[model samples]
Target chain A: MKIAVDAAGGDFQPENPVKGAIQAVNENAHISVCLVGPEAPVRKELEGLDYPEDRLTVHDAPEIIGMDESPAQAVKTKTRSSIVVGLGMHQKGMVNGFVSAGNTGALMAASAFILGRLDGIIRPTIATFFPTIKGQGLMIDAGANLEVKPEMLFQFGIMGKIFASDIMGIETPRVGLLNVGEEKEKGSETLKKAHQLLEALPSFVGNIEGRDILAGNADVFVCDGITGNILLKFGESIPEALQTLLFAAMKKNQIDGEQKKLVGGLLKEAFAPFDYQAVGGVPFLGVNGISMVGHGGSSPEAIKNMIVNAARMAEIDINKKIITSIA
Target chain B: MKIAVDAAGGDFQPENPVKGAIQAVNENAHISVCLVGPEAPVRKELEGLDYPEDRLTVHDAPEIIGMDESPAQAVKTKTRSSIVVGLGMHQKGMVNGFVSAGNTGALMAASAFILGRLDGIIRPTIATFFPTIKGQGLMIDAGANLEVKPEMLFQFGIMGKIFASDIMGIETPRVGLLNVGEEKEKGSETLKKAHQLLEALPSFVGNIEGRDILAGNADVFVCDGITGNILLKFGESIPEALQTLLFAAMKKNQIDGEQKKLVGGLLKEAFAPFDYQAVGGVPFLGVNGISMVGHGGSSPEAIKNMIVNAARMAEIDINKKIITSIA
Candidate 1:
């Protein structure tokens, strides 16, 4: 399988992606990578990297889509940008999937516009992995569509269930509607309607509250992008705030350096799941082909994980399963 | 000053409320408490408590409202219930305010029905204090009204601003609309419209994301009850989950008992603000009279803090200020 990496994307530019692509190709003999970016800079960064030349190659695309540029406009105008060019390769079946650690909006726009939605899909959604006590769970529509109808939310549940069962390896993944209360009568009109529609699915688990997200009560949780994005960002901030507060308390308590280091190490181990770099990236599910987007501040390891995960997703033919399930 | 305590409310019932009331009267020489519950149980619980006899008295309320009962129906039928009778005292001007640790929905229902709303107020909102890096910030509409109009959200901002200024003591609290993004064009139609309405206020800050809640970017944040309640409950569960995870890690690492105790103490102190017992209860803003509601599992200390907070709110005439501000 071959995956295209957007070398010009992300805050770190060509270096992280180039190194990550080299690492990915070295780790997986069955997989090959195409580094998509400006030719000279991409080659310069890959010069000293040790890897099989046949597994790693460069695809030059001169234009760049900036991190802050309007997503739809950039995808429309910057046709030669790495994101556009890379996704174009996936659209033409040149690569099995495409991965970018760039602007989320731009990547989502380019993927939807170029690759289009899967057969029988209403709208393609973004699915992010949320680390939970029972391992990790998936939340769909994590900022793809801010305003979604009941039917769209139901589709997200189905798509999320497929991803969880296929990639995350959760058997009969419990799909839940993210609501304020556990009771069926609770939540807004939209959620109430969505709850009813979700009952038709075999894996549907009534309604799950916000606390249930991290508690691992459900394998798949679905919501509109507005609520999902807020929940995702809020969950991400907890570990950071806790670390600062714990460090300040330790300092005030006059803890010795050795003990402080021990405490810090323990905290890092305990909070590994909350780290964005560790989780890597979220996939744009329901698209025609495999498309993954990572954090803009992703490190080489994170980018490599995204590439490996994208390739795995492609190998499993997740889109084909989703189409069959929806049909 | 006088405050009515719902002695039959909360998980620990008459015990927590009765002890909290006695503590409140003893702590404040000028303040008096009316314990509202079944005459026998309330008097039994209050007996032997060293408090000024004249300052703490029991008001007989025979009926009780269960936590799981339908809120509006319970309030309407259970007229002699502690929540109903306690709120009735405020309605009749018999007490300056009412405090309960019972069912949140029932408390909200009784407060709205008996206390009524401030002039020009369309609905009452629940405002909870969230611990932030800067200090503590307030979030409004924390589950009072699930489905809210844009105008209601605008009102929440106004009411939250008043509470932050009068109670939290921020001179000019920055009121922000809780949204998906910092950009003005982002968020749902209701939030976008609410943003425009909030701009007329002097201290209105633009859109704030969920991460900003704990980061303390704004003194006051407003959102629909559905989102605010989810955020509040989700935030409440973090400390518990973190403790469980950290303890397991410590056990696996074979940390000694002494170090475990020391780490436990430090974590307790660091997470003190996240403890609902420390923060006491949230206030029902926009009501004609002061109404404070504690968590169902509230300790005696939490109930005491709620009583004190209610007294302080009544002393400042927060409702009167809200009336004038809105008009």
Candidate 2:
């Protein structure tokens, strides 16, 4: 299987993406990577790196879509940009999947414009993986469509269920509607209507409250893009806040250096689950093909994990299962 | 100078309320407490407690509103319930304010029904106090009105600004619209419209994301009740989830008892800001009179803090300021 990497995208540019591509190709025997970017810099970064010559290759795409550019306009105008070109390759079936640490909005726009949506899918969604007490859960529409109808939410549940079952290896994944309260009568009018639709599904676990997000109440939690986006960002900020508070307390107490180190290590271990880099990238579900978007500040290790995740999705044929399920 | 306490409310019932009332009256020289509940149990709980006899008294309120009862129906039918009787006292000018750890919906209903809304107030919001890195900030409409219009959000800003300046002592409070993104064009349709409305206000600081809740980005964050309610509950659950995770890790590492106790002490100190009981209660903003509501599981200390908060709100005459500002 072949995966395309948007080397010119993200804050770190070609360095992290090139290094990640090399690592992904070396680690996965069945997968090869095509690094897409301007040829000169891409080749220059690959000079010191050692990898199997046959497994790794470069696809030259000169134009670059900036992070600050308007997503729709950028995607439309920057036709030869790495993001558009990489996704275009996936559309043409040259690569099974694509991964980028680029502008999220541009990636979503390019994906929807180039690859289009799956059959019976009204809109594409961004599904983020969250670490729960038991293991991991997926939250869909994590900033894709801010204002969603009740029908859209019902579709999110279906798509989230398929992704969890096929890629995450959860059988009959429990789907939940994210709301303020657990009761059916609670939440907005859209949620009230969606609650009825979701309840008809066999795997539906009814409404899950915000407290239930970290409590591991369900396998797939579905909500509108606005709520999901806010939740995802808030969850990401927890570890940093805790770290600042803990260190401040230690300083105020005048703890010994050795004890401080021990406590720091314990706190790091405790907060490992909250690290965004550890989880790699989140997949944009409901798109026609496999597409994953990582954080703009993703490290080489995080990029590598994202590549592996994309490869896993390609291997599992998640899109096919989603298409079948949504039908 | 007098505040009514809902003695039959909260999980601990008459005991916590009675103890808290005693603590409040004893601590505040200018404040008097009127415990509203069934005379028998309330007096029995107060018998052993030592307080200023003249400053503390029990008012007979025979009916009790259960936590699970419907808010509107209960408020209408259970006219003699503690929540109703307590707020009625405030309505009748017998008390300056009222505090309850009872059913939040019922308290809200009774407050609105008995005390009514301030002039030009579209809706009475529930303003919750959140401990930020730089002291505490307030979030308005934290479950009072789930679905609100753009005009109502504008009013919320006025109310939140007045409450912050008059009660919180922030000379010029920064107001923010809670949204998915910081860009003016981002978020739901209602948020986009609300964004334009908030921008006209002198204190409006543009949009604030969910991560800003703990970062102390704004003095007052405004959102619809559903989003605010979800954010509040999710914020409340963080420390509990962290505690569960931290203890599991300690047990796995087989830490000694002394080390465990020391670590626990440090963690507790670090997490003290997250404890709702520490902050006391949140006030129901925009009402004609001072009304505060605590968590259903509030302890005696929490109850005492709620009474003190109510006294502070009453002392500042927050409602009059809000009325003047909105007008």
Candidate 3:
């Protein structure tokens, strides 16, 4: 399977993507990567790196899309941008899938516009993986759609189920609507209606609350993008907040220098499990074909894993499964 | 100020509330306490306690309200319950305010039904105190309204400002509408419209994301009840989750038992500052009278704090300020 990588994407640009693409081809035997960017610049990043010469190729495209640009405006204006060109290659069936650590809005916009959504799909969404005690769980509409209709929320559950089952290997993946309370009557009119719609699925576990997310109560948690995004951001801020609070405690207790270091080391070790980049790329579910996006600050290893995961999705034909399931 | 305490409220019941009432009267000079519950049980709790003869008294209330009972049904059926009696006394001007650590929903229902909402108030909401690096930031509609209109959100901001200014002692409290992004155009149509509505306030700081919550970005974080409730529960779950994750890390790192205890002690010390109960009680703002609710698992100290806070609210005539400001 040939997967295109947006070389001009992410905060680090062509160097990280180039080094990562080389790592992907080196690590995975059967997959070839197409680096999409300006020819000379991308090739310059490829210099002195030991890569499979035949498998690693550069697809020249001159323009670049920024992280902060407006999604629709940028996609329309930056036609020759790496994101557009890479997705263009995948749209024409020249590549099986595309991956990027670019502007999430731009990636989603360009993917939906270029490759289009699958049949029976209302709107494609970004489903992010959240680490849980029981393993990884998927939260749909992480930041894609700010507001969603009941029908759309129900569809997100269906898509989440398929993605979790086929991609994450959870058998009979359970989907839960995120609500204020577990009772069916709780939350806004939209959430209550969405709860009813989600009940049609046998895997629906009624409604789950915020605390249930960390407990791994459900394999998939579906909600509007606003809730998911806020929670995601809030969860990210916990470690720093804890560290600050902990330091204040240490100072108050007069633990001094040596004991502080030991305690700090232990705290760091405990928080080590929350490495978001290790998950590689999170696929934009309900799209016509495989497309994924990593965190903007993702490292080279994360990019390599994204390439491998994209290839696996192509091999597994997860998109076809989603289409069949939804139909 | 004479503030009634529901002696039958909270998990600890007559013992904690009765003891707490004595503590409140003892701690605050000019304030008196009236314990509301079954006269026999409440008197038994106060038998050995030393309290000012003229400052502390008990009002007979035979019925009891359970935490899990339906709010409307409980309020309707349990007429002689401490919650009902205490609120009834407040409504009749026998007491300046009522405080409870019982079912939050039932308290809100009874408070709204008996004491009524302040005139011109769109809806009465519970604004809970959140501890931040700078100080406590109030989040309105914590769980009072499941769904809120743009008008209600704007009103929450106003009520929150008055409470923060009059009670919390902030000179010019800032209010921020919680959204997925800080941009004016970001989030759902409801949020965007709410953003426009909030612009009328000189203290409105555009929109704040979830990350801004702990950093005390605004004195009051305004949102629908669902968002606030979810975030509150999520925050409460962090310490335990961190402990679980930390223990796992400790086991993996092969720390000895002595070292484990030391690390655990330091961790606890760090989390020591997150005493939600210390804030006493959160007032149900926009109500016609002073009514506050503490955590269900409140200790005697928490109960005492609640009573003191209720008395302070009565003294400050917070309700009058809310009415004046909203008008």
Candidate 4:
């Protein structure tokens, strides 16, 4: 199967995507990659790279989307953009899936516009993998739809369960509704309604508190994109801040010089585990096509891993299984 | 000055409160404590404590509210409960402030009903102290008013600012409207309206993302309790989870035992500077009487610190200052 990578996406742009695509193509024998972006910068970054020509091809789309630009405006104006072109390839069945680290809004809009929502799926949810002590937990609706109903949350639980079982290989993954407290009556009207609906669900673990998300309380933690997004950012940003502080303290000799280095290194390392890049891209489920959106700060290694992850989703027929389960 | 202490409140009740009240009497020259709870158990726990009798009086309120009891029902049923008696003392002007580690809901309701909302304040907010790197931050409405409008948020901001400056001793404390992103246009309609309203206020620091809460990005972080409750619990829970995991790993020798211990100790120390014990009780701003709620996890030291904090609040006439400043 062929996968399309948006080379014009992300903060590092052509270099990370180009290097990562080449690496992914080299490693995965059954998968081929079509890098979509401007040929000049992509090729320059690809210089001296030893990649399988048959498996690695470039599909140039000169236009790019800016971070600040409105997603709706970009989709309307930048018809030949890399994201749009990549979505086109998936629509035509030229590629099995598409990946981008670009504007999240644009990716969601373009993917939904091109491939449409899967059967029985009203709106797609962003599924991010949160690394926990019990293994990686599937944190669904990380930043897809802001305002969601109880029905949507129930759907998120179903989709998250499938993602965990099929992709992460967790059998009967425990589903937990991320709430302020564990009690069903603890949350807002939306949460209370969702909790009642989730109780009837198979493999439901009841309401898990915010603390439980990182504590590895459940294999699958589900919430609306708004709260999920807030939690995701809080988890990501805190560790980043801690690591930075640890480094600064060590550099300034604010802590015990020799002891601080050792302690600081370990603290930093512990904090590093929570970083977004280490977990790769969050897959946008419920769409007809398999598409992933990596963080803007992701490195080549992370992008390469995301490519592999997306390929595995295609290989395991995740989209088909999700569609079947939801239906 | 007279202060009422709920001797039977908290996870480690009677012992902590008894020892704490004794400690407060010993430490404060002019302070008198009225320990409210069941007489026999409180006396049994206070057996070893040595303090002046005139300063330490027990106002027996035999009934106690369990942590799991419904807040509204508990308040309605347990009329002569320790928490209620303590709140009543505040209302009667017999005590300058009331301290409790009892049911949060019961405390909020009792305080609101007994003390009544200050003029222009609709609902009483539970302002909690947040442990931040650059000192502690105040996040009010931590879970008081779940569904909050821009008007309520504006009041929260004003009260939070007043508490920060008058109580925490931070001048011109920066106030932030918690949102998904830093952009002004980001977040829901309430947030946008709140953002605009907050901007017009003198101390408003614009929109702050969830990640910034722990980084000490602003002196006061404001949000609706639904979101605030989640964020506050999220912050408190993550560190607790990390500590648990770290200790578990250390116990199994899965990591460098000595090094891990040392780092843990340092983090415990660095984080100690902002521990709840040091911050004492969260002042119930916009209320007639000075009221603070200690955490159930608070130790004897925490209780003593809270008494001192409450005394300081009384000394500075925080309530009068806030009323005038907002007016």
Model 2 misplacement above 4 A: none
DockQ of each: 0.71, 0.67, 0.68, 0.46
lDDT of each: 0.89, 0.87, 0.87, 0.81
For model 3 chain B, where is the 10-residue window of minimal lDDT?
B270-279
lDDT minimum window of 10 residues, candidate 1 chain A: A272-281
For all predictions in the order shown, the interface RMSD in Å is 1.2, 1.3, 1.4, 2.8
**Which prediction has more favorable TM-score, 1 or 2?**
1
Which candidate has the top score in lDDT?
A: 1
Which lDDT tens digits does candidate 2 get at residues A257-300? Answer: 88788777777777778788767788988889999999888888
Ranking by lDDT: 1, 2, 3, 4
lDDT of 4 by residue, A197-232 (tens): 888878899998766777788988888776777777
Best by DockQ: 1
By lDDT, the better pick of 2 and 4 is 2
Cα lDDT tens digits for candidate 3, A1-327: 999999999988888888889999998889999999989989988888898999999999899889999989999999999999999999999999999999989999999999898998999999988766677899898989887889889989998998898778898888999888999998888998999988989999999988888778999999889888888777767777788877887787787688788778877866654566667788898888889999888889989989988898899898888788777
Model 1 residue runs over 4 Å out of place are: none
lDDT per residue, candidate 3, B132-217, as tens digits? 66678898878889777888999899989988887888988989998988999998888889999999999899899988887778
Q: What does the lDDT read for residue B79 in candidate 3?
A: 96
